[model samples]
Target: MHRRTFLQSAAAVSGLLPLAARPSFAGLYQAAAVATGDLDAVRGDGRPVTLPASAIKDLAASLRGPVLLASSPGYETARRVLNPSIDRRPALIVQPTGTADVRRAVSFASAHGLLLAVKCGGHSFSGMSTCDKGMQIDLSNMRGVRVDPKARRAYVEGGTLLGLVDHEAAAHGMVTPLGTVSHTGVGGLTTGGGFGRLARKFGLAVDNVVGVDVVTADGSVRRGDPTENPDLYWGVRGGGGNFGIVTNFEFQLHPFSGTVTGGEVVFPIDRARDLLRVYAEWSQKAPDEVYVDFVMSQPPGGKGGIALLHVCYCGDNADRDLAVLRTLGTPMANTIKVQRYVDFQKSGDYTDARTMGEYMKSGFTTGISEKLISGIIDGFEPHPARSTGVFTQHSGGAIGRPPVGTCAFPHRHAQHALMAAVSWKVGDDGAPHMAWAKKYWATIEPLTSGFYINEVNDESRAVLNANYRENFPRMVAVKKQYDPTNLFRLNANVQPA
Candidate 1:
């Protein structure tokens, strides 16, 4: 079989395929290692837990979707997530096709004392979506997208990917605020406050969320919106998937021109110092409709890395804006042009290529100082791996304008959200790359105010606190109210008080 064909087939059975889309996996797993991790420990803080073989068999028989045991034919493939760094072995993998199926899985896991992990697009950076010797609720087959043009809303299944949302919304001349990656799970991203090229104008993916259909820890289906189950709604906005399994989402859509002007301009490393200094100045003065980011990464087939200034303008005066942007610095290449919004959306999604060991660390700051810029450039030049680099979201427009304490995300006042990401081959030692990223982040740590929950790699409880701030208390209250047992503790969890 052709190499690409093998990858496509592998991605399908592995439940890693993107929606409305293609795939990615290079040097992933040539051989699946059998897991021998302990299965009898308690998953949450409440009590000791255990799941017997007969109970697992009964749960398997009860599911409409296929139940794959560890030794089953497709079990190995079904268990892989997007990040190669995470290789967990769930005792039983249950694929759920609908909300009813999801409720059954949730109920079974809760009753049987089985640790539960949820998988949508399988894109969790921390691998919190799956666990060892536990039970996995796989929603890969539950993807469905419906757009109501007249109502200006789109109802997306929790299993849907950003690509499908973009495709459906574009057909109706509308768009939903989401992350840049086309294949990322819409459920995880939105539940944790998603943002993308359009976010500067539309706020966050959570901000556009109108309603949600969730299955709580008790197996009861509940709906949350501004007026109904308001506290639950607030918690879900940026609280990760701690409260329940979000089976469906209803998002308010924005009217779009269906066309955007954006692309990348690459400059040599020597010019990064000057380019970055100007980028800091431009980020503060740019219009809400103009979204751009400075990304440092190894140039394709090149020796050293280059700084790329990527621009996505969804507003008018593109010609004028492009002219002014070009003046930022001399470029080695420019790809900016008018294109369909969906096309532009697909341009920079690194996940479209292949899966690899990846780590992402984030920090949010209200301002970017010269020292921070220098630190970023220093981090870029000495990357330990080819894919190790850094970037920041110039997010002060719609993102910062959201009222404080409106939702679980507390970094709304931040003008920039910095991220240091590193990727490596499956078997390569990640220590050096991680160390480089840490060293890079250390130089700017004093300037950081908070962190983005979605991009976090540090699983420590203290980092989780920084993501929620004063809102952690309210989230704990809601978690206690709905998930008092902390059944949904797989994500960036807030232990029920």
Candidate 2:
């Protein structure tokens, strides 16, 4: 059976069983307080805001979805985000079932000056999707995907997972460029510039976006496309979530066979420099249908660290295109074969879920240099307890075809997105792992350019401005027009000019 089908069946069975009731926040708050009653929350400026019991009750009644408070039954589970490192407690969580619910939640936040955070897949590396002592608009319950095969377009709900799109689109031999992880939220991934196995062949996920239904700071639902609301459309393509909540995304799909020749070729860590050098030269001249990434890491239960070339070829000349990679070094293992694209997309799901604490620093590189290859190899320090690696997400095919100011994402000329990532288990001191990641990134940072907004952490305002380059001014102008109050400032924020 397919993975998703099995999971759904398991979930249905689990739902038949009874669940335990946890303690509510009745004692902590007023003794007579109900789940959606009076609450004390924080404002956007760190001030206090009190919501009367009646107001809370009205807000809950106005929405079609459930409003969760600290005393709510599913509050614990609803407050959790994907990154285990982030531990935030929101005053309330509003699980919106549709655009109307989202608009109400946004308007409530705006009116009350509440610190607002939006959670789709809750996959923000910096935990921008959830906040403390604030209101969280959770979209987990709004996952719905509809594919128009005839039109070659997908209408995906904002909170939908990438795997659902892959599954639904594959049913009709269609696919959209999305992030590699199946569980990643389409809202965050596409809004912040998505990269994946098929990105080089098609383009960044933002490039495929045809239209969007967004709710801005004023609680207004607007359609953004080429002709209508053109500026808003351009901003939503690559401008992170700084403008508003994108309730729905319309993606242009490409005809696909549902299978691709792809897998990893692994070699010992000692050959990383040579393999990477070869990769730098070969990947530049590779066909648009090929996407290859270089990863250096120690696999679980392996004897030592290794260098891997993760290749995905969609064209007919798969063997011819991959021949140069095979001749580079004596690979320990080569698993390149034709496989279902959806299955390939889920290959890293288990590993990604196992990661409890992760710290990553990423930047874009126009071209890989010999010094960079040496620096990457020298900075790599493999620890038996933790997973640390330097990897590259291949770029520079159709991704660079768009002009710089065509959208808010300005890193169009980048050849690769490089990252230094470290992961540690739960209860482990992440300081050491994070330190190592930073040290490793320092060596290669100078040779790289800007960062991918989706993977960005705690970067300074000036650095972010510089990274956005010449497009920052235009982005600010759009921000001022759509969200003059900067209600959506939790992302790689573009402050209103």
Strongest candidate by TM-score: 2
Alpha-carbon error at 133 in model 1, in Å? 0.8
Q: What is the TM-score of each candidate against the true structure?
A: 0.89, 0.91
In candidate 1, residue 147 scores what lDDT? 97
Cα lDDT tens digits, model 2, 275-294, are 89988998889988999888
Per-residue alpha-carbon lDDT of model 1 for 1-497, expressed as tens digits? 01111122223223343423221121111111222332353454435676655555555556656666675555676678777788888877777778988998899878866678888887777888878877788788789999999999999999998999999999988998898867779998998888788899999998999999999999999999989999999999999889999999999998998998888788876777787787888888888998878776552223555676788899889877656665765678889888998887766554343345667778787888887887776656443333656677778899988787888877788887777776665677877867776777777777788787776667588778756988989999999999988889888888887
Number of colliding residue pairs in model 2? 0
lDDT (C-alpha, whole model) for all candidates: 0.76, 0.82
Cα deviation at 115, candidate 2, in Å, is 1.1
- Residue 282, model 1: lDDT of 83
Q: In candidate 2, which residue ranges exceed 4 Å CA deviation?
A: 1-33, 299-303, 351-355
True-vs-predicted CA distance for residue 304, candidate 1, Å: 3.0
Clashes of each: 3, 0
